[model samples]
Target: MHRRTFLKSSAAGALVMATTSWPLGARTRDRIRVAMIGTGLRGQSQLGPLLSRDDVELVAICDTQQVMLDKTLAIIEKTGRRKPKVYGGNGDVRAWKALLAQKGIDAVFIVTPWEWHASMSIAAMQAGIAVGCEVVAGITLQDHWDVLRAQQRTGTPYMLLENVCYRRDVLAVLQMVRAGLFGELVHMQAGYQHDLRAVKFNSGNPNEPYGSGAEFGDKGFSEAQWRTQHSIDRNGELYPSHGIGPCAMYANIHRGNRFTHINAFASKARGLHEYIVEHPKGGANHPNAGVKFKLGDVVTTTLRCENGETILLQHDTSLPRPYSLGFRVQGTDGLWMDVNKSIHVEGKSPAHKWEQAQKYYDEYDHPLWRNYAAKAAGAGHGGMDWFVIHAFIEALKANTPMPIDIYDAVAWSAITPLSEQSIAEDYKTLAFPDFTEGKWKDRKPIFALDGRY
Candidate 1:
C-alpha cells in the first residue's frame, strides 16, 4: 500500500478503537482541563509547557510527599490561575486514584515513577480520561500489555511522551526514509548514552538531588526513590525508549513489521559506585558510601525484526560519557550517522565519501518541525518537548489520535523488561512479544506522514 494510504488505514484503526468522542469537558471544545498526577520534577517540568498554552488549564496536582505537593501547589498558585484541586499528602499512597476520580479533568500527564506508568495510564483511561505519560519503558513486560489493553478496552487515548521520536533531526531522517532517500531499510543503531554519575550519586543526598530535583526540582527525586534501587537490584537495558523510539519509527515497527527477538549483554558495574567513593556528598558517612551498585555500567542489546531489519540498542547512562543518542540509520542505498552529523547516499554523493547532513536539512526537515520551529524555540531538549506537547494539545483539540499512540508507546517502551530477561540468562536470545498480535502487518501509520496532522 502507498504510504499515505497506510497512514489513513492506521488512523482508521485508532478511530474504531477511540472512545467514540472526547471525554467530558473536552467534548465542548473548551480549554483542556488537565490534571497532573505527580508533582515532582517531571510533573512540574511538563507543567511549564502546558501552562504556557492558552488551550490548556491546570485543574489538579497530586504527589505522595507533602513538601513536593506544596511546592507544586505554590507553582500553580503563583500563576494566579484558578487553584486546581490538590491531592496527596506525606505518605499518601492512594493520592493518585483520588486525582483520577475527579469529575471534570479531560486528560492527565503521568510523570511519576516507572512503576506507576502502566497502572496510572490504565486507570486514567478506565476513568474516561486521556493520558500523556513520561517514559523509560515499563517496570515489567506485562505492564506494557496491560497498558495497551486498557486503551483498547476503554477507547481512551494514551500517548507515550517520547520527545525523541518527534525530534527535529530524527523527523528529517523520517522524511528521507519516506522519500526513498534511504532505500530498503536494513539496520539502525541508537542508545541512551548520557553520563548520569552526578544524578545517580546525588540520589538521597539533601544537597544534591536527582531526577525531578536536580534540574529545577526542589525536592530531589521522588516516587519509589527508585533509580538507585534499580542499580542495586538489577541491570540490563533498564531504560530503552530513548534509543528505540526513533529507531522504531525509521523501521516502521508495529506497522509494517515488529521486533521478533533480542540478544542482550552487560559490562561490569563501576560508574555510580566509583563516583560515590570519589566524591561523597550530604553526610560525611553517607549510606550510599557503602552500597555496591548492581547495575552494569554499560548494556548492549541487539534485536531482529520480522522484516529482516536489525536494531542495536545500548544503555550507558550510568557511566561517564558525552551525551548522544548514538543514532545511525543504514539502508541499501544510503545512511546517516548522528555522532558526526553526516550522511552518505548512493549516486547522490561523491563516490565512497561522506557529506555533511546539514546539506539536506533545508529540503528534508520534517514539515511539523519546520512549521513550529519558531514557536518551539527554547522549549526544551532542542524544542522536541515543545513539538510533542504541541502534538498532544493538537490531538486533544482536533480529537484526532495521538502522534505516539498506545501501540507505538508500548512497543518501544516494552524493550526494557524483555532486555532484562535476555541479560539475566547470560545473554540469551529471547522472542519479543507481538504487542499488536499480528495487526501490525496490515496496519498503517498513526502519526503524521506527509506534513499533515
Candidate 2:
C-alpha cells in the first residue's frame, strides 16, 4: 500500500490499542495536564522541574521498573504535590500506553530509551497530546520519517528536548553567529566525545556508586542495563543530537539550508573490551570482557550542507577522556573551539594568538540565560535543561510553535542512521533525506530569537 494510505489505515488499529478519552483539540485548562513516561534517571531529571512549576500538573507517570517508579514518587512527595497516577508493574512494558489512554493529559514528556522514543512520541501525537521527547528522535531512518508523518498528520505539537541547544556557551556562540561575528560560515565540528566506559557498564544495585562495576545487561543498573547493548550491536554515530543540534542552529539548518549528504568512518572497537579487562571489578576472565562491542572507539562523520558549509561530527565514548562536546565553529573570519575555551577572530586578537572565550561569551550571552539564570540555578545539565523544558511548556501554554520543532528533531536524529548506513557501505557518501521535503527553502529560523522562553 502507499505510505500515506498505509498510515491512515494502520493508525486506527494502533489507536485502538491505547485510545484516549479526551477529544482532539486545544485544551482550555488553566494548568497543563502532563504525563511522564519512563521515570528513570533522565525522566527524574525532568520531573523536578515539572513538579516545581505551578502551571503544570503531572497527571500520571509510567515505568516498567517498580524501583524507578518509587524513586519518581519520592521526588514528587518532597515537593508536596499531589501524586500522579502510577503505571507499570509486574513487567508490563506497555504501561505507558495505559497512561496515554487516560483523560486530562494535555502533554507528555517521553524520557524513555532510545528505541522507545519514536513510537511513544507517535502515540502521544496521535492521541492529540503535545510531546516533549528526549534525545535523538528515533534509532532508524524510517523511524524519523514515521515521527514526522505522525506530527504532520495529527497537527499536534512535538518538541525535541535537546538541552545542549540551550547550553549557555552554545547560545552565546549562536548570538555571535547571528551578529556576523563568525563571518560567512564555512565549516563546523562538534561531537559527543566524553568517555563513557563506566556508564556503559554498571552494577545492578542502585545504592552502589554508578559506573563502579563492570556488569551490564541483566546485571546492570540505570543506562548500563540497556544503553551498553547499543555498543555491542551498532557501528555508527549512536548519539549525534548533543553535538549536531547546536551546529544545526548555528548554520540555520532546515531554515533555508539543510544537510545534503554525509560520509562516515569508524575506528576500531577495543575500548569497551579493554575497560572490562582493566577495571577492578572485572578481569580478562570476566564474561563482559568477551562481549564484542561493535561501536568504534571513535566514529567520524562528515556532512555537506546545501549552503556550502561542511560539518564534522565524532562519536567517541568507551575511551578515557574529559567530558567535552569537542565543539569547533569556524568561518571566514573567526572560530571558537570549546576544548581550549578560546576564540580567534580576524584582526580582533594578537596576530596568531587565541583570546580567552570568557569575555566573548559574556558579551554575547544569550538573553534567555541572562533572564533565567536565577530561576534555572539547579535544573541539571548546567541549567540548560530548564531552558528547554521552559520552552516546551511556554509554547504549549501559548499554543505557539516550538523553538526546536519536529523537522529539526528528525533532521538531527536522521544523522545517526544515515551515518550508520554510510559506514556499512564502506564510508560511502549518502544523500541526507530532506525530512522537511523542500519546505526548508522557505522555513524561517525561530530558535531562541529572544528571552521569551
Candidate 3:
C-alpha cells in the first residue's frame, strides 16, 4: 500500500473509532478495557495472562479466520469470563476497524501478522488507545518512521512486546552487565538461528499435527499461511527483534548509544526449496517445489554503535538446525557465550579458563526473576512471556513509560528493511536512521533496571 493512502485510511479509521472524547494524558481507569486484534497462536498466549488479571477486561477480538476466532472463543469460554464482542468471522479483513470503533477500550493488543502491525498500531494510537504490539514493528523502513510519527503525534502509549528480553539468562546477563562483571562493553553477537521449515510449511488440516505437510498459503496452518510468502518475496534478516532486543538493552541502544550504520551479507537460498521437495506430502512434482524463494538461508549483519560498541546479528531459519539465539556478550574484562553456556572473566576466572554459566546466573540472578519466578512458572517461552505482559500491564496501571518504547521498537525493527537494502546493494554499508531525532543522547535505560514490573 502507498504511504499516503495508508496514513489517510488510518486517520479515517481512528476518527470512526473515537466517538467519545479521551483526554490526551489519561492513564488509569477503573479497569483497563482491552481489545485484541488477530487471535492466532500468539494472541491466545497473551489472552491467557489478560484473562487471569483482575485489572483487565477483554472488551473485543478480531480475526479474519473463523477457525482461529472459534478456537480463541473456546479458550475464553473455558475461563468463564464475560464473552467479548467478536469481529471478522467471515474473512472480513477490516473487522479490526469495527472493533476499534467500539466505545470504552483503553488498550489494544495487536498480535497480528508482521504486515499489519504498523497500520493497526497507527490506527489504535490515533484513536487514543494504548498499543502493545508484537515484534518487528513494521516490514519496511517507511513503516517504522510512520509508526514513530504516529506515536509522537498522538500522546498514546506504544510498547513492543519483545519477550526474549526478559528471558531468565538474558536478565541475569543484564544484571551482570550493570554490575560491571562484563566490564567496558565493547562487542556482542546474537542471532535468530532456528530451523523453521516446519513452521513455514504445514497442512491446512487442523486435525493433523502441525508441520505435517509442505503446503502453505491458503492450504497451510497457522504461520505457514502468510509467513512463507516472505521467503518468496524478500532476501534479508526477516526477523531481527528476537536477537536484537536483549542485545540493544545491554548496549544501551537509544539510551545514550545508538546504531550508527549497518552492513549485511546473505547466503544462497536452498533450505526451503529442499524441505518442500523432500516432504512426504510434497514431491518434486508438487507445484510449490517449482517456487523460487528470495530469502537467503542465512543472513549475517554487522552494526556499529555510536558508543564505540559493535553488534553482530544473524538470521537463519530455513535450514535444519537446533534452536539457539547464538548470543555472545563480550567486553574489555570478560565475555559470555550462550552456545557453550560458558563465561570467562579476566580476574575472577583462572587464566584463560571458561566457567559454567549456571554459577554466574545463580550468583547474579536478576531480582525480577527471583521475585516473580513462582508467578511466571508455566508461562510461554520459559516464563519470559509473562514478564513482557506484566511490564505492559503494570506500566499502563502506573502511568509510566513502557520498558520498550517507540524509539527502541523502530530501531530494532528497522534492521529488517535496512539489511535488505544493504544486501541488495552488494553489502554496502547504510546509515541507520535516527528514529529518536537526536534525543537518544539524553535517553536513559530503564528496562528491568530495578526489577520492578
Instruction: For each candidate in turn, give its C-alpha RMSD to the true structure in angstroms.
Output: 7.0, 3.2, 2.1
Q: Which residue pairs in model 1 clash with each other? A: 41-212
Q: All candidates' TM-scores?
A: 0.89, 0.95, 0.96
Q: Per model, state how many residue pairs clash.
A: 1, 0, 0
Q: Model 2, range 293-326, lDDT digits (tens) per residue?
A: 8898999999999999999999999889999999
Poorly placed runs, candidate 1 (over 4 Å): 1-30, 78-80, 203-207, 210-224, 280-286, 450-453
lDDT of 2 at 440: 93
Candidate with top lDDT is 3
Off by over 4 Å in 2: 1-10, 13-30
Q: Candidate 1, residue 262: CA error in Å?
A: 1.0
Instruction: Compose the digit string of candidate 3's lDDT tens values, residues 82-169.
Output: 9999999778888888887788888999998899999889888888888999997999899999899888777678999999999999
User: Model 2: how far is 236 from its true place, Å?
Assistant: 0.4
Give candidate 3's whole-model lDDT: 0.89
For 167-227, candidate 1 gives per-residue lDDT tens digits of 8788888889888998999999999998875665444443346532221123335532656
Q: Model-by-model lDDT, in order?
A: 0.77, 0.88, 0.89
Of the candidates numbered 2 and 3, which has the greater TM-score value?
3
Q: Which stretches of candidate 3 lie over 4 Å from their true place?
A: 1-6, 9-30
Q: Order candidates by lDDT, high to low.
A: 3, 2, 1
